[model samples]
Target: MKQQTKTSKNPWVWIPTLYFAEGIPYVIVMTVSVIMYKRFGLSNTDIALYTSWLYLPWVIKPFWSPFVDILKTKRWWIVLMQLFIGAGLAGIALTLPTPFYFKASLAFFWLLAFSSATHDIAADGFYMLALDDSQQSFFVGIRSTFYRLAMITGQGLLIILAGALEIMTGSDPMYVNVTTSPTEQVDYNFENIPEDLSNIDELTFVVYPKNVTINTNKISTDSLSSLKEFAREHNTKNGFIALSETEKLKKNRLDGGETWWSHNISTPLANAIVKNFGVKKEVITKTTDDKVGNAKLVAVRLNKQPEEDKEIVLNTGFAKGDKSISIGSGERLVFNSMNWNVPAYILVQLDPKLEGVTSASFKGISGNIPLAWSITFFIMAGFFILIFVYHRFVLPRPASDHGSAANSPSDILHEFGITFVSFFKKRGIFIAILFMLLYRLGEALLVKLSSPFLLDIKEFGGLGLTTGEVGFVYGTVGVISLTVGGILGGIAVNKKGLKYWLWPMVLAITLPNLAYLYLSTYMPESMILINTAVALEQFGYGFGFTAYMMYMIYFSEGKHKTAHYAICTGFMALGMMLPGMVAGWIQELIGYQHFFILVILCAIPTFLVIPFLKVDPDFGKKDK
Candidate 1:
């Protein structure tokens, strides 16, 4: 007894392992299962329906609680159940990919649920048995805290790891050795032109002498003709004109015919004519030394020639007649007719050394040599550390007070046999079952129907909320309200006893459910109001659920208390399961507003159950 006292004194020793065992499977089934199904592209309704079934083991847990009580020490049940849970996790990790993996995974999860539920029973019973009432009171907070931590570890850490792994190993494209080069180059010359043309049109021509060698293959006559026509229309009689080869030799002749000498032609010429006449002016045309390099051209009116005019010239590798020059809206230039009306073409040559330039490519982590090694090393280290810690420290610690809990093999079989038989014989079990089934009928119905109804959009009776916003309202506000309601309900029950608090619990639970009716029918546009109402309903549920849990405890007071409690939980599970199973189909039939009305109507049964719950007059009274 003294040894038992010492072992129980350090309840912390058992909690981490026990809660860790409870938390991992719960997280896998409840949170990770949903996420995994989503990742695999399962629909919301399917995920909801399938995942909701995972809650079954928890609901039915109370039925098997007695075997742990009567046959073996709670400590034995704890270690064995932990082993079962670990195996179930291993099974899920391995079998999740099979063709029938969903069903198989469900099977494993059901096993895990049973293991987890049994663990909960043992852990809770052991907690009560190991400690005196005072110790139990003092350490309740510790147990709850550890359980929450376990939840965080299971839900948070494992998901992060899985996500990271998926990112690292996932498929991504790869690039190979490739190269690039500049294709061609053309140079031009500039000389023997009037400087006055600079102000007239700002035409910067780089011309080559007519005798310069050229690449006929590189020049297109069709392109050059288009430019010549444009230039002729813009050029005036005072501006330079393309002279015929015969006219080039006829020196000093530049009135209406082409001449070899550069001329500042600003007036209209006989052949030149404007087509789409709007504004007439010479424009500045800046040419790049290399045609391939970036160039600039600006438009300005041509007036007259300047005295100090610099000689205009053009040079290009293309033949005199095989070039293309573009004219601005109001600009033009002239040259000897022997010289083609085409301007010199410039091309910037690419260096041979720099020809191999290639684009930068990103090959994801898998193809990245450095990252692959890093990830491999990191995973290895993490794997070893986890294994060492789990086996060395966590696995050896007995869940119950008995040191031989893990080693004693037959203990589980015996406990299972007893739990199996007593489940059928418990007393007040029927009433407890009925109460559990009826208590939260309205809540289950509302939860099952609300999202589908709300998703329909206002025209169809839904609030038309976006997925993210809905998740936020339901997850954050709803969770907070649930906590608040539970706390308040616990406080109210402690103050007034079960009988007095029963009516309020019923009201709290039932009335908040009406908020859904308001939300569905009115289809409120204000997010704040909708969210507030959601929080309010959640608060009511939290408060009211406290009464429900307490009543279960009250009803489980006789010979097979654990077994009776399990039976009650099974009915509770049934209550939720029945409503949730067909909720989607029902929503399809009735729509949001009508479905919510059905939920409100279901509350009537919960309200009717209030009279049957007895309150202990001395419940809140204390002994000195």
Candidate 2:
């Protein structure tokens, strides 16, 4: 009784920190890790498939939710889970410098995923136990606010931090500039390649064919494809070789279930879908005798070797330049101990209708990637440790924060059986479960690949935004929009109820996906446009997501509300996990444009399931 009194504090005192801690690990596992792997040169296929599997712990968290209840107090679970999450983060930092960093870091991420899943169970359960029904309803918006803030921190601030750290720990950025003149007969291709490079403190870029000439006078419109193909054939970019077409189709042991399923089932199905509904890309304009783009070979090499024992990665792409004269290939390439001296050829292609002198530039930023990522994770680990310490003291301990009346192991199991049965036995539970499962299916798919699409070079049908830029777009502006939508959603639902706002929120979430379609088709460089799109989309998602959560809480209102809500979340995670696991594979098979189209098409299921959902007229209404 004394302990409970001492621990009791205002809900405002702890909800922010509690939910903030709850959100950090989930975002780190699900979102930030995708960007980290992309920076480290992991393929989209691997990043999506592997990271999507991290959702498994949450999918099956309900299986262990009862165990969480039967074993210890919610406070004990929350504190312990935080410590485990911190340990997992530290483990990732430790493993990043190792040779098997990929596998080792994945192991640690698994630890984070599981610990975070368990933490969600505890923290969410504790929220209900510590507050009365009215208090729970009132502070719901506050908790969600903090969680989204965590998303901003992880998705935006954390990524910006890593990107900044990348520059600090690595050499100064190297620029590969080009000037094109159609009238000039200048060619600066390397006559002889250097066999060895001397070590230097600074790295500078040298692009041969310093003056490019593209005579685009009266060529066939079809020449552009041929021009691009010529660049591809001439590119002998050394250091890394991509998988052959057949190799990408074949299954590997590392991929496990996702690979097998993708190969035998999803591939054929996807091919069929693409052949039918897929948008056909045009190789040439209708004009028969229009001037066509021409491709030029630009051999690139560093002025000096990178620092010894550190593998410096040079990520180069359009950093504000003439849109016509763009990199046809080799936007991002790595340089290391073995290949520092060997020159890699980049295909610089000119846009059709070029007849005069014009110049453009691409910038490459080099960084000690392993070290940068390690330091980033190290900082995250330290943050969790600090939060763990803070919550250990500040979290309120209510008198009702114990397990069910069952005091022994046998009694706990009996209670678990009863709780599980009651949850499934709830009125219209099948519809509730379906609503939970299908509500966020589209988001599950989109969320997984959004980062990859942002980081991928423009040449490969992506936005090619810098890591820091992606962070700000999604984290700051997007999160702010989402938070506003969510807050408004809670208040609106309080006034009008879920039934009144369901269809509007549905449109809110699904309609903004068109922003990606527009982005992929146009590939705009304006940050304002990009942020606006993201903000609208995130706002809709955050708003729509409030309805989903309220429905879960509404459905789980019962004798076993805590355990029942866990089951609902389990389904919620399942909705995200299954689709996210295959998002990358699909994107690779098709491209970002079609992949997004498919994501939009997926919204049909959400709409279909929603009409069938049963809701109370006064479920979320605030009492006077």
User: What TM-score fits each model?
Assistant: 0.53, 0.89
TM-score, model 2 to reference:
0.89
- Which candidate ranks first by TM-score, i.e. highest? 2
User: Over the stretch 11-119, how does candidate 2's per-residue lDDT look in tens digits?
Assistant: 8888899999999999899889999998887878788889989989988887887777777789989999999999999999999887788999999999999999889
Model 1 TM-score, 2 decimals: 0.53
Query: Whole-model Cα lDDT per candidate?
Result: 0.51, 0.79
lDDT of 1: 0.51
Expressed as tens digits, the lDDT of each residue in 1-624 for candidate 1 is 222453223656555555555555665666556555533333344655777787787776665454566567666676677667666666665554444556776787788778777777877766666665776678776776566555555444544454455444432322111112234233333433323444535322322221222222222333333444444433323243333222232433454454433333412221121212211232322224222212112112212332232222111111112112111111212233322233322221122123333321111111111222234324423443353345334332234344334545587667656764675565555565667888888777676545444433332345644333444565456655666677677777777777677787778888888888888757676779998888888888888888788887776666656666666677777788777665543443345566677777888776666666555765532320
The alpha-carbon RMSD values of the candidates against the true structure, listed in the order shown, are 28.2, 3.7
